[model samples]
Target: MYGPLPARDPVFSRPLQPRVHPAGAGGRLRQFRHDAFDRGMSPLLVVDHVQSAGPEMEPLPHAGLSVATLLFEHAQGEIESVDSAGARHCIRPGDLHWTLAGRGVVRQARARGESLSLDALQILVNSPSDLKQQPPASFHLAAAKVPLIALPGSRLRLLAGQLGAVRSPLVLPQPLLILDGRVDAGATVALPLPAGWNAWVYALSGELALEADGAGTRALPATTAVTAGAHLADVQLRIRGVGTRSHLVVVAGAAINEPLVQHGPFVMNTRQEVMRVVQDYEAGRLGRL
Candidate 1:
């Protein structure tokens, strides 16, 4: 992992398409995704500083993936939801939920309740195609139980993955780290990544000026990609911001290295397979509509 490298000023090189929420509406709404399969080997998308639109995510089907969500509450906030199996659960402010959707699990996500500016992040890790059938599981990590990495003039919440000296929340299929770092005005934190993994950091609250190796320098707007690479050894990050939990998702993973056929929430390997999944769902293969 590389660290303390200056952040590069960011210029959005490519236009970003809208996110895919599911179809249908009322009480709460979600974005529906059109099958967008381009940009091979790239799976990192930074959704920075998106205020909770009263986050209401219902049971949706997710196959072959794991999701990690963080809610950094300056005061208090909560997310409520029922599982695909109709189980009830909620995560309060400062708490986190890690969902591993294996094989064919029906899952739902929704954010409820509120406070002024309840900011947080969610990162998804693609499970290997062969292990998509693994039984899905959930882990709730307490805010106090998470590791805090202290730097010269900054403090970081070690959410997931590893930073040179600090370890992350759980063992993952891919090499990814999620850290929330806060630097006072002029304070700087060297963002070091691990070997055999690529890293990217997005600034959610404060404007960040970044300096990168090949990408040059640029300023990152809210919900922008700081650095992205195929392998872990190829990326580096650094930042200067004045804020708390300058919320960011540090993601690193090997490219799917194959056709990523995704129709809405199901990310499969081929269009034929994706079509089959749709047919199966329609035919009651996954169970329940």
Candidate 2:
């Protein structure tokens, strides 16, 4: 007989918070919800758009924020970006772009194709005070280079951080894990979550069920997100497909108990720091793009 299995905790499900639609040069972007620093997830601030696209954009300056972009769909166009650190790159479809607005930086993205169809996810995270002033860093993860795990009726992709025994190449300012998976109907998957880490599950398409041990099951629909935490033990989230097919993205990170203050593209620990960032940006401290 086999040895005893590992202890697993169930992942509770909840409804997505309010949705926000913001328009910019990136077209009209959809934001799922914002997590608070005290009662909810701290480091992960915003998850924007299951699918988003925009026309050519002018250069923009920012500070005190970190961004992660997941591009799952695109056409002939490419995205070119340059930051304050003088790092520049061009990104295509099925790629991930991470920008750390440590002290300050300037960035710009434009659609290159004639009629590009771009779909992506924009993630905003808060950096701790100690690392906020470090030089801005940026990375590009190609779609073909990302690792993939195949199951019986589902496929798992490691976007950031480690999963099981595999690790991702993309590095962030924080210890965060992001997974993208697609499951066929009638399939069930067990997702392991570390104890005490805050977790979020977003349904990209179709419907599914998320359940924990003591918590009841909840439905997950397309373009919706759910948050879960309070795991005293290792939680094994059970996700079952309730429709023809289901697509999901799971994000988890340790909670930061520090103060969080946000203003526009700036996210800092105190209002004083936020004001400093604004002044820095205005004084051209972030440098030209």
The local distance difference test score of each candidate is 0.55, 0.74
Task: Please report, as a residue range, the 10-residue window in candidate 2 with the lowest summed lDDT.
Answer: 33-42
Clash number for every model? 35, 2
* TM-score of every prediction relative to native: 0.73, 0.87
Per residue, candidate 2 scores C-alpha lDDT tens digits across 7-104 of 43245534664365655444556675454312365467888763334665677776777877777643345667667678887777778888988887
* Runs with alpha carbons beyond 4 Å of true place in candidate 1: 1-41, 45-50, 53-55, 85-89, 112-118, 194-196, 230-235, 242-248, 285-289
Residue 247 in model 2: shift from native, Å? 1.5
lDDT of 1 by residue, 1-289 (tens): 8779655333112212335343312221111111231222244422323344454556577666666667775625576645554445676667667776665566666666535344555655566677565666676766777888877767787766777777866665555566766665556666554344444555655555554455555555555444444343544555665443344444555545545666676776767766766776666656552
Cα TM-score of candidate 1:
0.73
